[model samples]
Target chain A: MNNYALSISFIDNKLLLKFSGELSLYSITTLQKQLNTQNILKIKDIQIDLEEVCFIDTATAIFINNLLIKYEKLDIKVSVNLNSKDIKDTLELVKNQKLHSDKLPSPDKESFLYSVGKYIYIYYISLLSFLNFLGNLFTTKIYYLKSIKNIRFKEIAFEINESGVKALPIISLTSFLIGLVVAYQSSYQLKIYGANIFLVDMLGISILRELAPLITAIVIAGRSGSAFTAQIGAMKITEELDAMRTMGFDPYIFLVMPRILALMLVMPILIFVADMMGVLGGMLVASLDLQITPTLFIDRFNEVVAPKHFFIGILKGPFFAFLIATIGIYRGLMVKNDTQSIGFNTTKSVVESIFAVIICDAIFSIVFTNLGI
Target chain B: MDKVIEVKDVKTVFGTRVVHDGLNLCVNRGEIYGLLGPSGCGKTTLLREIVMLQEFHGGSIKILGDELNGISHSKAQKLRREWGVLFQAGALFSSLTIAQNIALPLVEYSDLSQKMINEIVEFKINLVGLKSADANLYPSQISGGMKKKSGLARALAMDPKLLFLDEPTSGLDPISARDFDSLILKLRDLLGLTIVMVSHDLQSIYDTLDRIAIIDNKKIAFEGTLDEVASAKSEFIQTFFSDLK
Candidate 1:
């Protein structure tokens, strides 16, 4: 509620201000602004009468104290006429606050150029640290290669279940929808030219060579990549990673390798599943929309869709897996001493992995086009 | 002479584990009351029950004349604003600066202008022994002690008649804990607050709490001032209070 009343007047070179009602932070601003627009400097004396004020909070109390100080600094006579001990005690609280406190140091503000320089510096440091992490991962993998028995097979199996097998439902749903929509849309044009049977050729080639692998990789990047970041980041925050290091366990070998190996091992299988589901969807749309029988669709698919296209799609899986796992684990290790940074790094991991997958796909397109695959 | 809070035969159960059965306690107005017990003895749980954050299996908790059980939504909200709670880990929102954290309750519940809110926030910051410059830092950016102080400032923002603190001095250094104890005493006398705190710190208990209730075996083992607690026969109570010379 706007529950305060304020009035001001001048009498014999003295500015008299009277306030009433509940004087709290809710109404102090209006009173301050009104007092600000007045010609109080011209008066020789100032009087603030809070006799009718029923309640006053710390904000109003501080305001009254400031008014007394501001006018008194001008060598102007100031008097406060209030009888409430509550108000008096609040003012005294402010007074004690001023006397017994060490002001905390605030952060320094930087110029635009300085901020740019700082950003570049931070980027450089992070790049160096990422290179270090990559080097350590390579060495750890090579060292564990000689003694393959040292690998954490249990953790890798668990991760495969988490990132690969558990992802089948969502992957199937999205891939099937995409394949059906593409077949339906392409059949619209193909039917106009009496090329209804060519729907199988289009769906088989595209889904096997590009759509299945790319879609599956993108989904994994969003799911497993983000989980890797958040899990590791939480471990880092709780000092679990540090505890492992202190106990003579290398985190890269123990934690990072299991995730990387599991994802790489599962990616190709996940893409194969996506290809089957997508083709199943396209086969349904082919029979329903184009009046092509299931046998006819299967015949066209097997005769025209080359094995090289399916192999090419599967070949991209491990590379995409490597990119997603490395980026995810790298971002996780980048987390600082806060829960917020874990969230920040998790978001960065997903975006970077997805972007990298697309870029890697573009590179594959260029290489295949040149080699005439 | 007025009772600010009363827990009558409160029973709390989780599965077959009975945390509190037929436990009772009362807090008088304008007194600093401590809820003390051994670790995992349900001191924090009892405090949570009183603040209405957790529900009890049976019995009623009355705060400022309103029964918590079967209370209406609007009535619960009104009762909520009448007091403030400080959690163990400070519980400041990581997304907001310290100033914004303290200003949140006032902005949400009052018609105070932004400028006035800032003034009140500044006063509260100072009142809790926090510096004005520390206002811009997020909860994660500040020290543990500073975070506790910020939490205390936020708790006092509405000038609540009752304050609930859970282990306010647990993680603080000795100097900061002592400072917190004196701050509690000063704020209690100045604000006339009836505080209910769960504390393991012996120094804080002796320095601030006018009365204490020690929970043992899911019931109130003893309830009185520190002088009266020494005579209690419970082994847990003797172990806890015997260290005090």
Candidate 2:
């Protein structure tokens, strides 16, 4: 199955090329090597033998067909000796395929302009659908004011537990480690000049105003965002979403709204917890490595970091939550009716949400900097 | 004279409901057999049980003279090679093209060359009255009738001795349903296959089935030739056949 070996036999001016084993992609290297050793010009005539070939995939069939065509071009009277009708029919089919399919979008005709246009059109369609989804979501939320019971509070509570409560362990762990690394690296230079107290200033502002919320958003995007897409994508595949719609239930309210609302409500709380853990990690590093006491670090932290800095960080939570939840829910609901689409959409949900969160963070930084927060 | 399928005292339960109990049926070789029942009457469950896709709670079911409930895995696989099933909605693999879907059985079970596989693929597709060009299209690209036809072609890939059809004429239009029934009759005549199909289409049942079995209240209410079923003296049979009016 792995190797397609070929041997050439010369008998009385007429050369016989014997094909042994499978002539497939895995064995293409050896097949090409064996096929090249024969001098078709000097032999005057050749017989292509297939008596020993055990099997051939599509790639091997195309290879053998092309080799036969090359021999035919050399004016060397070459005859095919396929012992089985099966092989002969396969060669015919592959030959037809090459002739018919080759005429489609040949590189000679369409390349640069065609690809650029195709991608632009695809992106335009996706962008339009995304805007449309946002419009529908806004309308649905507005209607929630008249009928509050339609919001599915139980499902929202469940999602809060899943996306918010369940993610605490990993989020806190990563944030703690990130805090320790930043503190250690910064204190490495700070301790040289006995500026250990400034480590408190640097770690306090960075962990609260930047690292904690950003890191928490990313972890939740990976964990809960992908989970939301996969869960809804599976429901879409098995026709559960359709069944719900038929039974007088809105998927946006019952499925998407709960997930979005849960993430929005719990994101600030999770980020707050992560901020505490991260500061604790930095404080632990300061006390052990730089000889800064627990009381001194806290006293320094309180003097430099204002309440507005912490508020600015948590303020980005609902925005980040909206971006992640919307993208994930949109990708899931819009997935095509195939299992491959589930994986494809899930990956997209995670990647796009992460990218959007970073951009949102940068914009928040610029706005907050200008406002002097 | 040859019995292809025998079901005796078979029991099927779904939660609190007993779908089938002590249901007995015998199908002969090379005959078109139809299973008729109302909605939620366990016709599909019985088909699944016979095909060994689902297990029964009790009793014996024999297919091709082998006890389906007691057969070993290897033996079941060997038996499976001799029969083909066309599920409801075709259940054609969505990813693969029609030709590849039909060629799957031969490619896995036989050592035939690619040329032979292609030939068999084209032949079965033609046997089911599909155009040669239809072979390259995926399941989603085709219409519902085409999907059912391609499903039929896939079922007949290995020249199975028995063919099972689950709601073969359900989703098709009236004209397409009639054509499909004719195609089934043609294939059965050509291949000499014993066909057991579950259908609610009266036209299809009357047109294709040589014999009919009616299941009611967890048992076979009647089992006989189509003509015998039409004339059977029973309350269920009277109401069931009266629907033909």
Candidate 3:
């Protein structure tokens, strides 16, 4: 197949060649011949229309970079019209890299130290700002309470069912497989000690304390967190937030509260489902590899994993939900009235939500460990 | 004339930038007041302050004789019901159909039955000149002018006594802009509603406004009827008029 197509048109004494498809090593010779036939040497202005081009790898980018350099030397103005912003950004980055290849270097000793120091300073400031925000959140409990009072319970419940219930099957399947893997991995080592029953303790504790919460948080971060960000960010960029305020609606109460409450109520249920699936996954592995009956596996699971473990797992649910929802809304609200800001805040919301969940989980782990629970 | 909105010595700053420095203006009931200025002249900021969306550094703002600061959150929200704002980009929810978009406020604030809500939505859709069939289509599936009309329909759903429009004719063709202007004029005449608009479109301002407030030099440059503004002879006003000549 001819992987590339090139169309050349002369308009207003300008050579406008629209290039579509790929520009590869094989196609480069054909492109060169076509350009030569057009008397490119005499062309004053050459416009490369990349509007239909799909992919351009490093080699093709380099070839184009060289062509641009050669055209500049021949006193021909070269312009490119690209379809996708990603492609345009890649080309710009490639051009910059080519132009500044010699000047670029790994950071020196002092510069590295300075960079580390700067990062440290930024991290410290961000942490302080987060703490301050949390402090404000607590101090203004009345504001939160008032906002909470305005939440539409029916609407929030519907949204919870939509976001949470619909995601159950996949979450359950994945966690079940995770549990099975953990059980299978533990059985081999436990068999060596003739203490295979300890596999239950290991699998149960790990899933309840760490794996379930972490997996659920990650899932929700990608699922509900991104949705919250996109919804709020879009609203922000479109001035719907402003419209809500203008229409005698408190945006925080109408928008943020509903989502927050929905997530808060739904997360615990999701976590419980995840834990059950994880145990079932362990049961599957136990039944298959260790020749243990399902009933025996359940009894073992019950014996080793205490009620506190379940409580601890459940306790982390609301905190994780709060972290995800709060960060999503906060980052979304930070969006400026621009498309770039909206995208930036959407990505920021997902990353920040996941990061906050993990950090909060670690704190909970530390506190639980210290309390000897 | 009864003042619907009054801003006295209002100042709004964004970090280090002073967007509105001691700005003051007034809009009378049943009058269409246009805030006219170049881009980034704090017209949007002024609108936000009037709507109680932005906090003023130092000033007293009274909406329908209620002190802006003293008004409770619910009271402010109730006051907001008095005005409908059509944002620059229409701000329609992409996921919602035109009918649902129009019905949002009514569903949220009113205790109307679904049949009543549907009727109201249909009435609004027709009021903005959109067909009943157009109600099922999402915002992204429609044209820009249609989206603006849908937004206006939603804004009008609350049957507001006051209306605020920000760049209502922006990004629209001349024909669409004219149609929108005519619609605004018709709404005002029919409903006897007060309108506060921020726009740089001179034609829209002249065609619809009872009086125009020109913002320049961090304050109101002039506030009067269009003819009076035209005769002011200030350099800014003169240049502005000459540009359209």
Candidate 4:
């Protein structure tokens, strides 16, 4: 039932008593009995090393404090050594609490309202800070561009080509399935009006202007965004960022710039490939269901999905890429010296990048719709 | 005994907590300077400031006679190339092999060919007393002492004039700690490099340091040779030294 365990090591008359386990209310009587049985009162100097101790409660602190006072009266010195700061601070707190035990507790009613108002103020400040960050991004972009040029472009090209090009097959296949589903669904509706051939136009426009970019963004966000966050986050937690700084290397240049630029370059190409695959998927469905010739479908697609649609879709590519890389790097840099912060930032990066991509897509949709493209 | 690093009236504050207040120190060339203090006494913070990893709010730091704050980024990087740091916990890249870790600085900073870089990595590895076969092993595959050695090898890859180590002997057995200390002494003697180490290991400090700086009460509480520090009249220092013994 004893909550505390103490082992004494005698080294040249120095009594080093190693205290371990918990020291709580349940253990105090047993502890006192053990101390008395060990003839602890006979010892001149007792070095109570709490380094190995796991837990110390109020009861333990009071017991230790009383022992110290008792030993003081006996003219025997008592010294305590605690390994952890938290434990030491907690013990100090226990001592202070004992000193002020007679004081009445007063709860402030306005504390809740104060906290709410403080949070609101923080929210506003954060919003303004985000705007400032956006403004800094433009200035940072200039520095980033200059620094990007310093990076081994060949290395970046290899990384991007590996990450982006290798992903093409999966992206193409997924987008193709999306196109096929759209074609099959629209065919059912179009056949009701006896205008089934128009399914080509519907599939073509949707794949080109919306589905391709949206799907591509999501895929890249999951793949590249996560990679960016994990890579930078690992570097950060490991002091590699500090290493870079000490080496006189701008981490933004050595790490972030290449990543951001690589994503920007690769995304547009990936989107283009996705668009082609999606259209081909639509063609497969159209020929199978509508009994339409491939030539007729191509003609309709070329007529319906104009250069404007292609341009707008491709435009979203770089923006989405930028969003993913920026959010990833920003979140990665935001990570503190802890593993939990890294996980939190990585999740934030993925969520923020995806959200930003969707919001950008909405804006593109509204703009293209208004422009009559 | 030329002054390689000088800090005058430096102050660093994170929010309301003053990490360093008016802390001053001067480290000479070719001397092993040890900063011995309890946890959160700003030893690491001071080391960070020396390498320009952390900024100061007041006063100035001069490394090799160049004002730390005034140096341009590229210039600072060049300055950093002259100094090597072995961070606490080794901090080796998980993905990189020992060879790749050692080769990083040479590859990044120098125009050495792959063959030359390989030779340099081998030489550095051997200098740290690790076999060339150990080069391919990742940091996780090695023991803690080996990792520390690998970190030391990586730091020395650039042939830096100054070496900074934070808790270099931490988390090692007595023999390993002693071996690491000997390796540090060997590197310093062989290369004639100045070393600034932050540590609380009394044995290591006494065994290796030419001088010691004691950080306490948000400032440099004491700075002198080990004998002077041991013989000092200060209650805190006396208690600290006695506790270590």
Candidate 5:
């Protein structure tokens, strides 16, 4: 189907190129290469004969137009002879496509300074928008306090099941393994100093004060935070949020509140579970590595590790939950009207929430140290 | 005229809910053929089956001399390049600009140079009546009419011999719908394409379709020109085309 019969002849400083038999994109390349070898630069005129050609696609038509435009620029006279109405229509579509005039150049690369300024501008705007989102969230909650019975308890239960309960097994396994590693590593230094009995105090304080809360928050940020962004982003893309607004339902109250409330309520319980599991893992390691029996480990843990350490760690739970949920939903609401935006926002939510969790943890650490807790 | 598509005794069943039973139709070369049916009559399903997007339970459908049922993978891929299907939503890739979307098939299937590919993309954009300035815009930035035209341009990118359109004018305004109708007729005349469209837009059917097959009660009740369908005794034809007289 691509066999274009080509016959080129040069006479009296004029080039005559005849083409027929189904010229299309597949044949245009070969035709252009063949025409390039001919010394048409010295010619005064060129004539493209398509009288016998029955069909021509848009690509071939554009190729022919490009040839004509090139010759016109070279001050050489050009004429295109065509027969079929189909070919005539194709040529008419591409008749005005000049090479340099119609062709779009690749976009210029942005300068480094320009990109830096652009990112700063974007972050500043996002910061303001986030403050605005926080204000709206508080006002919505305050307004809904009068009709607290109208809140969706069923949706909150569902969120708790999905984000909190479903996360139990993984969090338990991770924190348990982390506690075992920390206790085992500390056993070596204790044994060297002949202070192996102190393993209980170290494991209890570290797991209760740092590892359990921090690790639990990170895992939830990875799991449920990303889910919130993807769920809300998809809803935004499908216009479900708009549909809810049109139905006189606020998406913030209907969609965002249940998730936030459920996470805030369940965060402390999950953290408490993580703390127990991490201590159990450390106790197992202490018994195996240092010959500290469970009873002895429990006695020393109770004597030295005060309840304030656990309470302090649990105190950070709701704050971390608020950060993760708010950042996730904010990124989700920022999603544009395309599928790609969902993925972009989901990634952003995971990263930003994890970062916020660590920063919040650090601030808590600093405040407790100054207060001598 | 040579037959470009032939669907013989095709049957489609979704878990015993029979959609099409013993459906038969033939589309000739260089004509705009329409599949007209009420909602849930499986016109889109039939179009999908013909394009190999969906499989039929029984019977054979052939296009461009290749049988669709149980076709080889390599042969199916080859046949796929022989036609272009414009989905209902224009289905332009959200990640790419309009020009890149139109140039995708050519870039994937052909060895054309970048310069030639760009020129061909421009030609197609102009062919579908889109402005050259709109080439760099994403699909979300364009209006409904522009999106449909961009989709038509992408469908025509490979210069296929056959074109399948699913409700091309369903979401367009009246002026845009008529413009799309004339554009279809013009493209058919210019490219000699054998088009198979599933549409219920009566105005589009009257304006562009050379022949139509109406499906009712799981079978083709009428298959002929508009004038021929006017006299058919089918209830759907009577009710749907009654105002045409």
Candidate 6:
């Protein structure tokens, strides 16, 4: 039902551009390219015709308003002709708000100094907030120790079941699939080199040492981590967190601590289960695809997969869980009292936790390698 | 007075349940009309339908003389500027300061100068009995009653011919509720606005409404002036009055 199209025509010294589509953020690029391809100095005037424009949003309005300012500054007489009352209303809104708005210059229009200053300031503030969050978490833990009876054991158990037990089926499936894929791909190369029996050795070491914990943490970051952010953010939006504070209860102790503790306690168990499933998957593929019997696969797997490698992988679990829970809680707590903020923060929580998990995994590998593990 | 809002044979159905059927209501200029009923009686649903935020199953809602049924995009935007809806939470933009919230509509819908916009923002803020200093505070920084006032100020920003208030006094204290009622009355007198309020506040109903429409058994069981509503012999009306007391 959205019949949108744009066309341009030249008349003497003026360019007549007609917009028929929903002139929104999606169409701004084409609009910008039209301006880019045209030689502004050769054309003295440009008229935007909005007769058939079906809709216009704030982003489009801001873009057009900024474009007009640029044309005006360049001595290009720009005008807008409209028959649609809808376009008039949108432009009217943009015009009224233009004075107080942050004149959106497309990214290329932004000054280098402004970008640098803005990003630096943003990062600095984010770092400070993170430190503050850690400090609050530490003090809350101390407070929980003093009032152990006040701690929400019931909620912690509920969270453990939700984040740990509920995640079992999906985690097992992903781990098995990854292990099968890894074995299938690597066994072919090993077979060509007449090292077919080495399939179990390679799969076992890789899955237990790196893949299992890393993949599980990544999955949990997207699922349970985002859930934490959404739950906490919704609680914040409904003012339940505020209500707790005013009622002489620390939200950190009652709300945040339980979630963080549950995730931290559950991650090792999840990773261990993931390791078993993954190795089993490798054994299945090795026997079926590589002609290695199940007994031979097990013998090689047991001989090559060292306890030190398994220990090193599982040790990263608590750390990954801590980062995921901490990042999630931080993002959720940072959420402003609005739907947009909740959505934005939940997305940011998932992305940042996954990134953090991978980075921490890399650091763990490097430290373990240096320690001769 | 010309009717600003006229709803005829309006019907709303959800799955197997019927929310409204053959419901008709007419509101006149410079008058406050109240809609009252038990919970889930579609009072808010009717308000949403009237505001054009929702579509009815069957009805003709003629707003300010323009029929809302099958209204085009351009016509809808035009109609939107002529009326404002105040949600129960005030629904102020959280990121914007109070003045920015009030100025949003004017900025979006008018060609007024920056100074003029600021002046109008100040005027609206003061009209709602807020200090000009409050103009710089965010919605979160304000109390519930103040948020309602800010919401009202924003609702009045575009100088809408019709104003819709949804549960305006639900979370307010008695003094604040009374103050809100007086403010609504004062605004009606000052601006000649046609107000459509959905409320359960008996004080608000008695203080602000000139006419009341009560819903019962899925239709308007009673409709009349406040005094008429108070003395109506309908069993539902009697219990409403008694239960509220």
| Residue range A109-190, candidate 3, lDDT tens digits | 6688888998999889767866775665554445766665554887688779866898798889888888988898889988
Candidate 1 clashes between residue pairs 3 or more apart in a chain or in different chains: none
Give one digit per residue, the lDDT tens place, for model 5 in A1-373.
6568788998777799999898988998899889888887788899889999988999988898888888999999998898788888888878844423655798989999999999999999999999999999998888767586757797799999999999999999999999999988999889999899999999899999988999999999999999999988877775445423322246787779999999998999999999999999999988999999999999999999999999998998999999999999999999998999999999999999999999999999999999999
The TM-score values for the models, in the order shown, are 0.57, 0.51, 0.77, 0.82, 0.60, 0.48
Q: Could you list the chain B TM-scores for each candidate? A: 0.97, 0.98, 0.96, 0.97, 0.97, 0.97
| Model 6 vs truth, CA RMSD | 22.9
lDDT of each: 0.88, 0.86, 0.84, 0.85, 0.87, 0.85
A-chain TM-score per prediction?
0.86, 0.74, 0.65, 0.70, 0.93, 0.71
TM-score of chain A of 4: 0.70
Q: Write the per-residue lDDT of candidate 2 for residues A1-373, one digit (tens) a residue.
A: 6656677888899888888777777888777877676556676788889878878777878888888788788877888787877777788899998888845564566589998998999999999999999998998788765587667788899999999999999999999999999999999999889998999888888988899889999999999899989888877775456433322245787788899999999999988998998998999999999999999989999999888878878988999999999999999987877999999999999999999999999999998889877
* Model 5 stretches astray by more than 4 angstroms: A96-109, B1-245
Off by over 4 Å in 4: A1-110, A117-149, A369-372
Model 6 chain A is weakest, by summed lDDT over 10 consecutive residues, at: A240-249
Give per-residue CA lDDT, model 1, range A31-70, as digits (tens): 9899988986678888889889988888888888888888
Flag the better candidate by lDDT, 3 or 6: 6
lDDT for B153 (candidate 2): 88
Clashing pairs in 2: none
Ranking by TM-score: 4, 3, 5, 1, 2, 6
Error at A107, model 1, angstroms: 7.2
Clash counts for all predictions? 0, 0, 0, 1, 0, 1
The C-alpha stretches of model 6 lying farther than 4 A from their native spots are A1-110, B1-245
What's the true lDDT of residue A202 in model 4? Answer: 84
Clashing pairs in 3: none
Look at candidate 6 and tell me the lDDT of residue A239: 48
The DockQ for candidate 3, computed on C-alphas, is 0.71
Which segments of model 3 are wrong by more than 4 Å?
Answer: A1-149
Window of ten residues with lowest summed lDDT in model 2 chain B: B87-96
| Candidate 4 residue-wise lDDT, B114-229, digit = tens | 99999999999999889999999998899988888898888899999999999999998998899889989998999999999998787898789999998989998899999898
